[model samples]
Target: MQFMEDLKHLLDISYPIIQAPMLGVTTPAMVAAVANAGGLGCLPLGGLSPEKSLALVKETKAKTSKPFAVNLFAHSLTSEVSEEDIKIMENYLEALHKKYNLPFEHKPISSYRFYNHHDQIDILLDEQVPIVSFTFGLPEAQILSQLRERGVKAIGTATSIKEAALLDKAGMDAIVVQGIEAGGHRGSFIDKEPLPQVGLISLVPQVVDTVSVPVIAAGGIFDHRTIKAVFTLGAAGAQLGSYFLAAEESAASEVYKERVLSSTDTSTELTQAFTGKWARGIGNSFMEEMKNSGLVIPYYTYQNSLTAALRDFGKSGGIADIISLWAGQSASQSKSGSTEALFNKLIQQIKSDTNPIF
Candidate 1:
């Protein structure tokens, strides 16, 4: 009872659900819809410049008066890709690019720039966002202090117990415990080594036990069953991503949505080929070819720019093989509907008498 009340109080939400931030896939309307439905809506600001990030935040605020979170990638864009390195990746993709008959060339190294979201924090402050979340790593303690001074709640993503403890020690208002079953980018930041994959069922309880702040469980969570399970595991709230990929307000292409809908629990793989960062997505031609070619480039933002054109072209042409179909292990369980309608269904499940705990 205290957990439920504490979460609702902390997030200013009616339900213990959060619309997990999807960097490029979610839309302002989708964020607003979740906010309007009384759940926290998180808008991911990765891959966009600070100016663009602020514009998107203002747009979402214009659509809803309720509180919403704005998330940014905490990755450093060091630009370690040498010209020779670019040649290897480009030469490899050239053949496939011609097979698809799209102009093939390496994007200029000058085209890519990555920052650790410092400017984005300034934008969030200027916009007076109600909540801010960081993935990949935590922001500076002073930044969190500033946000708290301005009444902005700080949230961070943790893939392991130690990561959660770090965020808790950093004094974040909440920590999103992202298990291995989660789709999209791996939020493991503390270790430069291969991070151990922990499942949601096992991860949430341990994180909750270790942290004084609220724990929001994110992974292969779908319908209310998984949500209840997380809550029972001691998570204060649930965070879902693929569940809304097909929402009318989402920006995902038809091809992407179709692929997400058709994927099996075992169809997804964690590959760094697309963005030079390990992220879970359905296997495709590009993923397969990159896997066999043994090419690695600059980390995300930089690496993501190299494939931006192909993904755009594939989306426009309804070609699924060349584009990413980002989804969680429970991709096949997702349904299409308006965000409001989906939230209503989720609420019905939450209110079910079958769930003995509220």
Candidate 2:
């Protein structure tokens, strides 16, 4: 707990544990449960508009008086697609629709707007939320300065030391050192080159040594042993996603949770088929078909919208073969349990392992 002592000034939490802000999967109930249990809970507001986000924030406030963070996508707005690129995506979906014998709903792909962080920033500023974190990319210096001025803590996700340094230089309160074993999209800044495949054990120490800001270790950290290891390596906290996804309060679809638990091997693979940008998920029939077809679609929001219907349909019908089961490499360790129980288990395990001799 002494290692966690430093985070109190930054995050104001009793435990140096943060429930990872899993987009599309983490719900308000989940966030409230973790925060009420003494860990920092985060709600991913990437898919929500300003109005909806405000409502959710209000609901979470009603649920718990504890501090929690709201996450936003800080990436630049996606560019408009050309007619030819649209045709390619349409054709690709049409083939899948026919094969699956599903209805091909071809509406114009509405341009997905990047969340207006400025608008949400104003809302959070007014609400005076304790913490705000960002992924996909860094925000403008002015935004960072503004949050700091308002006494709100800011954090950024990084998959490399260079990115961590950039965040440090850009005035982040802390940097989440996302290792290669992390699920969902890899937070690689600059070009999408092959990321350095460093595991959490190796990644945390180096990043802690390299950066002056606090390093929060993430990726493949599922249990107490991993948490203790990260703390020993100088991490102030550990951000866990997959472990929380299996909790009863999580909004992850039932089928998705089953797949994560049923998976015998932790054989998650990185593929760009779902979102163009590479993300790690459980391998399934859809991924196999996409791989065989060799079809690389447009960037995230476009391809994400194009396949939204199919994913929903597949998930509803209890078919995991086609849905995006975004899971981390340590996903096999996940189990179905109440959120409070899971949090207590993790905390107890850490205490049991770290107790000194009498």
Candidate 3:
């Protein structure tokens, strides 16, 4: 109840929980389900065209009237691919295709060409979305101000103390402190170089200390004990991702669910092999082989697009070894159930404790 007082009121939700906006996994139905279940459901519009993004927003709106958030990737985009990088990556992927007995390609096939933020924000404003959140980086202050003027709350993801402080200073309604243990792409864009892996406990309180705005703790928080641990560390709320991967409403493939559910705390690792951006996911042939092969490639989204087809091939063929199987360390503890059921389970766990010690 105490934890709920700040975030619940801030987000206008009965509970202070936030469902992590997992791209390629989080669905509109899932977002609606989470909103209806009393948490801030977030829909990730990363790498989507404006039209496609609008379709998802409308779909979610049709299902639930409860407050929900829309998320976007705020990282810089590369429109043109480098010829040398493309040639090298194409050869590498061709070999991988042969090894996996998939189709071979001579040229690098592109995925999403443009990641235009201004156009996407225009769509959000046009739709009159309730809450708008961003990962990778923050949008321009003026753009964010436009959202606030139109009565939309803003949330930003931060993987480091510095990033969190910047978001707070930039007037973010809430900051999600995305610790190293979080699944999928690291929402880090402050430093050009890679950041040191900081766990939830070490990062949360530090960011909380540096920022005046409310901070929502993310990563490795799958249980009530961990939820209370986050609050104990000064977080206003918890954002759950891998915990709901096995939920009935989740869009994760059957193999992905099995891998996440069957995994142990020691089973996953952070690797840039999948997307050319550091992220935590389960160990498989593709990740291990790519990391060990010493293949040079492009960065972030461009690199992510280069390898997209292999993931597509893997997913369609039910080859778990090649696709990205993202999961946090607490994945083993995650349960499979309906969205509402998982939400209630969290509430029940908290209520069971007379007072969760800080």
All candidates' TM-scores? Answer: 0.96, 0.94, 0.94
Off by over 4 Å in 1: 105-108
Q: Deviation in angstroms for 44 in model 3?
A: 1.0
Best by TM-score: 1
Whole-model alpha-carbon lDDT for candidate 1: 0.85
TM-score of 1: 0.96
**Residues 199-310, candidate 1, lDDT per residue (tens digit)?**
9888999999999999999999988888888888998899999899888888989989988878888989888888877888888888887888766665666567778778
Clashing pairs in 2: none
Q: What lDDT tens digits, residue by residue, belong to model 2 across residues 157-231?
A: 888777888888898988898888988887776554666567778878888888877889888888888887788
Model 1: colliding residue pairs: none
Using TM-score as the measure, name the better of candidate 2 and candidate 3. 3
Give candidate 3's whole-model lDDT.
0.85
